[model samples]
Target chain A: MAHRWKNDLTRADATPYAAFMNRRQLMGGALGLGLIGAAGAARAAEELVPNSWEDITQYNNYYEFGTRKDDPARNAHTLTTSPWTVKIDGLVDNPGDYSMAQILDAMTIEERIYRFRCVEAWSMVIPWNGFELADLLTMAGVQDGAKYVAFETALRPDEMPGVSYPVLDWPYVEGLRLDEAMHPLTMMATGIYGKTIPNQNGAPMRLVVPWKYGFKSIKSIVRITLTEDEPPTSWNKANAREYGFYSNVNPEVDHPRWSQASERLVGGGLFARRQPTLMFNGYADEVASLYEGMDLSKFI
Target chain B: MSIADRINPLARKLPTWVVYVLYLLPVPVLLYMAQTGGLGREPVKALEHELGEIAIQLLIIGLCISPLRRFAGVNLLKFRRAFGILAFVYVVLHLLVWAVLDVQTLERVWADIVKRPYITVGMGAFVLMLPLIATSNNRAVRWLGPLWRQVHLLTYPVVLLAAVHFIWVRKGFQIEPILYLAVIGGLLALRLIPKRARVAA
Candidate 1:
């Protein structure tokens, strides 16, 4: 069945590639535009300015590499993403280790510009190139009684410095309900801005659930399991009080240590004011129905 | 000559204001880096963390003064006041950056301070420093006499709260913040040793 969902954001919405390469040029360009066309530039500024590829690739929360934001960028190069094999099992008809080449051959990839909101109250607009998660699940053949889908990240202690520290339970995990997993908005991202994703930004492949907080999008995926029981998540296991399993982006449901009502936009320079966080990270219109009967505050 | 005897004469010759100047040198450099993209993708956050870390470092250095004098025979006692004042200045800059550039709205700032435990703890540390900052001058020190030492004892709780704030602000049980807390706990524990025991040593 073809997905009915259409992308509200276009390529023009993305931060320019040239600008990503040199931010000084972008600033100078913005200043030049402001001088020439004040009203037009003001309107342009009002529109979403997706984070540069540098911002997305450099600042990451991939704890497998390390805890610090820049640690992944520095250390993740050692991870061997090539010849990767993902183990797909549990309640699926065709359960086996599918090679990355096979998966890419089987799926039809597309671009999705999404607003990524982190649980830490920071956000970025990312343009991802991937296939819908449903397509991959359908290919694997999800069996009956599979209520939930669990995902795991590759754990390599030698390659990943952060794993040795016990920053998070090794092999970080995340799960989503079967219905939510089948949603068209749920994606298996392979690249960013038409380039193969850098190791720091979850190389080879990663899950992208725009409606949920960024952590829910498990990176460097090694395993996918379709199960009846709700699987544990890394952040939730570390501190259940602060990080809920659902971990949906909800302004009303603040993290115990910090408020989620507003978020700082990355690559907006030092003086950029924090913008009010949107419910479902501005994808509520498409995904709000998925949680229709359930209470978000309780789940979060 | 003893190491202290050799170093103390030069230390005394160096004006105390040089300590203030040296400590404050990073403020402008950090601000400039933040403006020019040298602070990385999230300059605001990097700036905030850098400022807060510096403030905590200053507080830790302030805690080191008595220990350095007693255990190491280093007489940095005269520069202790500059460490406190500079730490307070960094804390103020950190708070201002969050309130003005980061939070932007007054209502949200107040709500965050009230609702968030980490922010509440951080703000509590900031509030406790007020009385200490007010009485840091020589006139107030002389006027309060022995009572001044009792009031300045607030440094223990302030440093503890600051460290706790750092730990609580982290997403997970990170070693960096925990190390800060451990160092602070150790420094404060050093005060428990009797002066007679120290003299005996």
Candidate 2:
């Protein structure tokens, strides 16, 4: 069957055009400074590059590992990704633990380049390699009563230091409406840029819901429960006023502390001009129908 | 001689202009780091945070001046004005980075200051510092005399507002901002102690 969601974006389109121009200007300034080595200057001139894996891996908010952005990179190495098991239960015919090998063998994997927008008003273009989340749920044989799909992250207190502190309720959890979870765009990613996902970026497998805020794309997923009720999400539970359960990438809905009207492109360096945030993060055409006849502002 | 008596002679030898130079050093260093991508992926946010942190640190240090003299016998009164002015400068830079670099629109900036309680508190702190910064000079100090101390008393509210601003800006319950608030609160509390008891101790 032809996929309804066709990816018009190539790897070249990952970084926005303005960011490329900004990098070029920055390269010129760097050369004038004579601080950058010839090798550094050459690397800087490369256009159409997505944020390097370094940026994606190093700058993270994997609170299971720690709260600070760099903490995950430094601390996530302790996480055991190999021989992982995902518990699939709650309104499913096959309600049991599925091993990584079983899950991978039963699914088809593909690369999906997506715009990742954080609620903190920063964004990155991530090229994720994985399979549609629906495939996994189908494998679990989701029952008729399932209205929501809940996900839970692996909670190993011995491995994750951030759990020691009451940052948020441990074993970070997230959820999506069953329809949204089954959407073709919703992916269960196991790799990034053609490599095994780094521990810092949620090793083994993670959910990637591009249209929603990044937190909705929970990391290091260990459980999938199809339920009849809307499951509570970590951020929403932490502060419902700021983080709504829906959390669609809506520019109009301003986060109480900061403006969501615009976002700073992560790889665009320090001086890059802020770009206006897109409605549904530029995927309105595909996902807008899911929320028809509903007020997004209220849902958000 | 007491340790503070010995420290006082060394402290006296330390020039007031050195405070300005030392405190102002972070501005260029941070800009250079931002330019070179040393501040990680989100440099604008990092720069804003660093500047705000420095401003708060300076404000805390400025607050220590009186208590240090009254209790510790370590006089740093000469550098107090320098610390206050430098902190104001960083506060201005922090606002500029958010307004000019991060937000980048006048309407949005105004809207944020009005709508966001944290930004409003931050702006209130900035506004409260204006008079303190303006009068942080010898001529104004001479002209205003006793009234000058009363006017500068605004620092208490300014520091409280700044601490609240920091606490509110963070996404989750972070310990660092809370620690800053606690330290500031303790420093402010010290000012309430009886002067005779403080001197006697």
Candidate 3:
């Protein structure tokens, strides 16, 4: 009952992380209560975050925690949330483990609204409040042999029952090419809805690779390893066809199973209709330059 | 002959109440359709959610019978035929919903079953249930004898497949489905474990 209705139009463009969190805490963070009272008021207004509440909950592609829309929301609670640490190692020159508290203290978290696209053909525009992934790499000190940046989640099968699945090797792993990892659009998310990330959402740490499918945004990261060769990714090794190494959102490269032309917007009614999925999920202007002339079909 | 003597003897001899109940056995599916907007406005997702749920529930009911008759000393064997068919009905609905609404194409559907591990398992379960459902009548049961029970034991594989299907459909694993899987798994395991078997093997 802390937040019932919000007048989003007149509110701060980017509320301080603490101020936004304080209001969100009062409102209980149930999508749109404090942020949006009516639909049409901001019809033509510019928003930093691209997602609506329905899209946020419905298009969940959080594979690091588990495979259900609500699974991560449930099992991710046991993460040793605060006082977190990230090990920055491998081919990096300044290889060391840094404390989560230190990272937060050293950096200013910003609010950037992004449209999230799932490979399953759904999309959401979410306003993520976090620091940049590049800033962290700069802080970590990347070196020459670092061709790939690999991320690892905490491997606590006891706490997370999903790890019991012999589907693949435990300790969910995701990786990015060094250039992709350091892209400006790629973020290191710490909070959402202007508040500290809730327990179900990967807290303490996670990466946000905008321009790629949602799964590429790894979560609950405990280790960051910069490698010379392409790191062996968890999904590609598990099911190579449905998931790919690049896993970028490309309409030309249809998933082995489903159509990429359409998407079911969550919270949008069944038959409520879906929108056309864009190439690189509408971030083509900013990131398309990086993949220019590369055959997405072959790369995919 | 007196007018009363003209009544058909078959009607007089048959268990009219049993026939009526048997004919009305599809009430669960009917009720489910009505409650979930199967005939209402929010048709597709509503239909999808209901069918998925019913598919699992029907499978649960199918698994419940042997245990019920064994542990509870109950004669719920009477409803097993109807319930198994109900499970089939729900599964078909689940498939149809996925096919017509969820995936939306024959090529995509076939590719999905072939490409995805869970979809293959689900289709396998669906295929195995067909013969059991086709042979539901007493005549077929009597004809097949012990082979009928052996074929029906296919339910165990079906249960496993359904659980896998549930687990893999979402991008992340959900504990709710896992809990159901655990219960169904334990119960199915109980039926087979030699140490736990109390009835004459």
Native contacts retained, all candidates in order: 0.80, 0.67, 0.14
Cα lDDT of model 1 by residue, A199-237, tens digit: 998889999999899999999999999999999989899
- Kindly list the interface RMSD, in angstroms, of each predicted candidate in the order they appear: 1.0, 1.2, 6.3
RMSD of each: 4.7, 5.9, 11.5
Model 3's alpha-carbon lDDT is: 0.70
Candidate 1 residue lDDT tens string, B42-159? 9888888999999999999999999988877889889999999999999999999888888877888999899888899999999999999999999999999999999999999999
Q: Chain A of model 1, TM-score against the native?
A: 0.88
lDDT of each: 0.88, 0.88, 0.70
Cα shift from native, residue A49, model 3 (Å): 6.7
Using TM-score, rank the candidates from best to worst. 1, 2, 3
User: Whose DockQ is greatest here?
Assistant: 1
> What is the lDDT, from 0 to 100, of the residue A67 in candidate 2?
80
Which residue runs does candidate 3 get wrong by more than 4 Å?
A: A1-49, A52-67, A157-161, A164-167, B1-50, B56-77, B99-101, B104-201
Instruction: Give the better candidate number (1 or 3) by lDDT.
Output: 1
Candidate 3, number of clashes: 16
Which window of 10 residues has the lowest lDDT sum in candidate 3 chain A?
A1-10
lDDT per residue as tens, model 2, A1-300 = 114364765675557779868877886786667544442435312332467888788889898888878889999999999989999999999999999999999888787778889999898888889999988898889899999999999999999988988878877999999999999999989999999999999989999999999999999889999999999999998999999999999989999888887788787776676666778987787899999999998999
Question: What DockQ, on C-alphas, does every prediction get?
Answer: 0.75, 0.59, 0.14
